[model samples]
Target: MALIESQSDAIICINETLMDDELRSILEKLENEKDKEIFGLVCKRWLHLQSTERKKLAARAGPHMLSKMAARFTRLVELDLSQSTSRSFYPGVTDSDLSVIANGFKCLRVLSLHNCKGITDVGMLAIGNGLSLLQSLDVSYCRKLTDKGLSAVAEGCHDLHVLHLAGCRFVTDGSLKSLSKNCRNLEQLGLLGCSNITDIGLISLANGCQQIKFLDISKCSNVGDAGVSSISKASSSCLKTLKLLDCYKIGDESILSLATSCKDLETLIIGGCRDISDMSIKSLASECKKDLKNLRMDWCLNISDSSLSCILDQCRNLESLDIGCCEWVTDAAFQVIGTGEIGLSLKVLKVSNCPKITVTGIAILLDKCNYLEYLDVRSCPHITKGGCDEAGLQFPEYLKVNFTGNVVEPDVFL
Candidate 1:
């Protein structure tokens, strides 16, 4: 009878412990996605009971699709599970599951869930509200990104340095102001293809982020000369690399401003900007001059023979120059470059689709540019055996030379 009484007492103790657990869940109920996942496995009863709350479990498990990590999820600092190679799409998770993860991962500093099509702004806000200590976030290519997600970023992560929102179609300048004012320490920022971002936001960014080192606003059609000017003036001391590719609205004024202000610029890309002319090109060449190395002005319609020559003369430190599809430049332009008087430091030169230039121009380049590593003079009807022989004879030590056919074809000049 005593043994039976002892067993009854043990059952009572078990029930009491569960009651205590229920009370804890109610009082200090952290909606942590990770914690719920762990709590779900405390016993067989809990495991089955939490099966109904699989969505909650996943939030704690992180954005990663890995199966079960209750022990390790509590100590995580950063989570980046961008693209997956999944064959089966699970049905337990909704767009709201991300919110649970954010709540659970409170101490998280960096988070990258780029291209996660399932998550929405609500999920992002949940993270912003939960993980207030975030320092870096990369939500690039998330098509549903709107002011809701951006507002959360402003509300939470204040010490962010890197923010990449490439391909997020809904981002505009209004949220950008909030981001600039709040994230006072941002450094590397990428807004590639964010067409909605206007000049006002660019100005705000320039004014706010005094320490920006790398900025990519490529394909932002709204960003014009005024935007460029703001960036140039604001990022003078800190800006190092700038990409203005496909910014068709930007013209000579922007180039001029960037050249004059960004003195320490190393790489500058103005690909497909049709309105830039000799004056702007000259300004950049003279300002950064030897300091500039990589430059791409491919398909710039306003570029003329005089400006290209001036660039070659002044920017002697140019390692790569892409003047492809510049119709105004003639074979004479190549003659000056090939003559070896202007492009001594040139390693890669692309004058492709400039039909006016002939073999004579290329031959001169091969002779003069002894340090040439890559040369593209494709589609110039005049290019023949003469230019190839000259390049082969002069720069035999330099490898990776491509002048035989097109820019894509790799030829070993050495």
Candidate 2:
């Protein structure tokens, strides 16, 4: 009799545990997608709840599959259909597929269509007309996109916060003017490889979108000091990250203006800007010392030990530093970096192609930077493969060291 009573008690406990509130709590705790799927398979109610609650999905599918996905996940807020892989044989997503998505996913706030070559202005127009709540959009490397599609999006999605148009070669000032007229809430804008964009377009963007916090104009060859200076003046207090890589026309004047205006500046990438010298760097160190974290000045031939030393002494919160190809930077800068509390915070250090940095400097840096994760000393004239191998033995297991070349010894059979 007691055994039967115990069995009844166990069954009652199991029934109580599978109650609606308890099951929903279990579903909320599940972090893995596979686990959630398995949980939903337990009952019909679970399946219905999971379908209604799912908010994000990433899929590689055709028009029919996208239609099915939209029908099922109607509450989805984020969707990633990026065909970034080089699969030329597969027919990419088309305008009709985008039309299906826009009509179905009305609550979408983030959409990424990176490298979807088949999509053109027609698809963009559909998205603009439907996904009015979209705040972030990435169409990078969509080479067919001209100013018309982007203008349509800018007009409709006025709440856009992030827009990445990298490698959209056909985009011109007309798109920028449209964005200026709308998209007042734009915070992050990436125009990398948009060679047609000049100072005039940038001036319009800066004047209109004064709340921008992050901007990447890398490889925009037409951008000069005037455009950058305008951005610095307009988004002075809001700007945090600025990437001017390969913008040959950017000189000390624009950098000085940024240092004086953008007090909250954190990450600055000036690689390939050969015109920038120690003067601008020193001023930057003095003005944005507290907030400056990640700085890359690779190929800036004029920055020497003095500028490096100033950064090491002032920017205590710096985490990643890349001074590759700075011909004048020597062991003196490393020595200064190793002596103080600054080195403790550094996680990534790249001194590649610096002829003056030797094995001694590397040893000094490794000894102090206990948490260093990535060290790139490739092509340094004074650093040998043997020395790097020796240093690797002493470094933490997580640390990655990139040496000059791959030298594999031949197998010897005696």
Candidate 3:
């Protein structure tokens, strides 16, 4: 008999068809959510089994339904109630909803409340006080959260390792101090757009969380050379990824410190750091060349052809590179990348807004970077639709070219 012939028939026979524990275990191993959803619809027993076995759930529905969610999914290990989409404009998860989650999901290890506008300091306090087993928490873009809430989290969630507070503008040095003092095992921290964080906070964090492996201090205007130097000295051995995007106050001194100290850095983003020049690029190429895989220096106005050449020559393991908006970059840099071993492993390259780049450079790039999958040449005046079409014809079918801001026709071989 067909499995989905009728609801009543399927319900009556589901147990007979899927009776063995081995069969149930095999069905439970299906990882796709859509597959699990289909499996759940087979019968009431299947629905109950699926709900109880589910370890991860992304609740995009309204906050009022969280109680129902708790009643349905009792074994959730990771719960994300973040209203990351436009649905956040309407009232989403609130403090009361968070309280229900904190009380219900005792096994919760990862929780994300990112962009949940209704979530306030009270919600965070509930999460901290209740979810002692929480390890990774992302409350990024929760503009209403303040130091009081963060301090409570630090005090309660001692096992918290990954914390993302990007765009929490009100968080000050005091909050960082509290986090550093309490969350000693914190390994990943993101403080992007927290403008008030300065040398004092960073130093405190570095001194306390020496095991930190990833850090994003992007757009923290108050964090300068002194702060970065302290962090590099403390986390150099363990730090694997560091993003200093738009931190205009930091100059070559900070880069020098990082290049000299952080030997294990695999990913680095200095996007919009206007002060970065060849000096630091050369130092990074010499220091962490083999380890570095992803590098972004978008809008770094000072970088020139020499710096690009140095990077391509030394960083042989690079998988992705972005030097978008660097006006000084020319065809010469592209030539350096396309001709050498640098292009073999490079999968993504973005050179948008560079007026000096042309069709000749791009053609060479397409020829050399056999594995390149994504290329963005937006706003490069010299790169025309015809040139891109020619490159598309020559390159593999998997290549995705971004020709925005260029005079290209609709559906032009994307």
Which model, 2 or 3, shows the larger lDDT? 2
How close is each model in CA RMSD to the real structure?
A: 11.0, 6.0, 5.3
Best by TM-score: 2
Full-model lDDT for every candidate:
0.72, 0.85, 0.84
TM-score of candidate 2 against the unseen true structure? 0.88
Give every collision pair in model 1: 33-60, 34-60, 338-364, 338-365, 359-382
lDDT by residue for model 1 (1-414), tens: 011225445523433345545734542474776776676556655554454333222232333533233223554567665654363244433355566556665656777766666667887778777777888888887778797888787778788888888888899997678777888888888889999998989898777777777788899999998877897898788777888889989898988898878988888889899988889888888898857888889899888888888777777777778887887788566545544355468777887787777766666676677677777766656555466576564446564555555346332110
Candidate 2 stretches greater than 4 Å from native: 1-26, 338-344, 387-398, 405-414
Which window of ten consecutive residues has the lowest lDDT sum in model 3?
A: 405-414
Question: What ranges in model 1 sit over 4 Å off?
Answer: 1-78, 84-97, 104-107, 334-343, 384-414
lDDT of 2 by residue, 1-414 (tens): 011225446533333446667766877899999998987776667776687678889888877888888878878999998885666436787899889989989999999988888889999999889999999999998889999999999999999999999989999988888888899899999899999999999999987999989898999999999999999999998999999989999999988998899988989989999999899999998898899888988999999999998898788788888898998988888667656554547788888899999888888777777778888888998897687677674667877787853532111100
Q: Cα deviation of 241 in candidate 1 (Å)? A: 1.7
- Candidates in order, TM-scores: namely 0.73, 0.88, 0.84
Q: How much lDDT does candidate 2 score?
A: 0.85
